[model samples]
Target: MSFRLTELAEADLECIAAYTAKQWGEAQALTYTGQLTHAFRKLGGTPSMPGSRKRDDLAEGCRILAVEKHLIVYRHHAGLTEILRILHQRMDLLLQRLF
Candidate 1:
């Protein structure tokens, strides 16, 4: 099945990039973006993985993950999974927790 990332997800990445750029320069931000995108793409095929989350407040139909030090949120619908957002693992992950 094909997958798409939500606009919020894209914007989340941009926010990270901007933050990282201000602190570590654009190169690091771009590099981190690449990693985030890779993880997002890897979300394909498997509807859910061991460290993934399914949030209700955001999309009402979403999935998520806390990989490394970052959080990747997504959703699978009609055979297609779309990433919703990405953020620091330490960033209020309660919303993405498996509770």
Candidate 2:
């Protein structure tokens, strides 16, 4: 399966990049974002991969995986994995409109 990000997820990534660059450095930002990109590819290739969990409380078929301090929220449908959001682990997911 392939993968795509929603508008919110894209924005989330942009924010993450900007914040990491400002707080750490361009290199660190790139490294962190690259890891996220790698995770995305792995998830696209294997949505059922271990470490990702079904979040039924959030929405049907919703799954989440943690990378560093962020969570990758995604779902599989229509033969593709749709990334709904990239949020900080500290964020209250229940308050977010994830699905």
Score every model by TM-score.
0.73, 0.96
* Residues 1-57, model 1: lDDT tens digits: 466766776677788889989999989888888887667667777768677766666
Candidate 2 local distance difference test against the native: 0.94
> How many steric clashes does model 2 contain?
0
Cα displacement (angstroms), candidate 1, residue 91, comes to 3.5
Q: Cα miss at 56, model 1 (Å)?
A: 5.4
Residues 1-99 of candidate 2 have per-residue lDDT tens digits of: 599999999999999999999999999999999999899899999997999999988899999999999999999888899999999999999899885
TM-score of 2: 0.96
Worst ten in a row by lDDT for model 2: 90-99
Q: Each model's RMSD to truth, in Å?
A: 4.1, 0.9
- Look at candidate 2 and tell me the lDDT of residue 48: 75
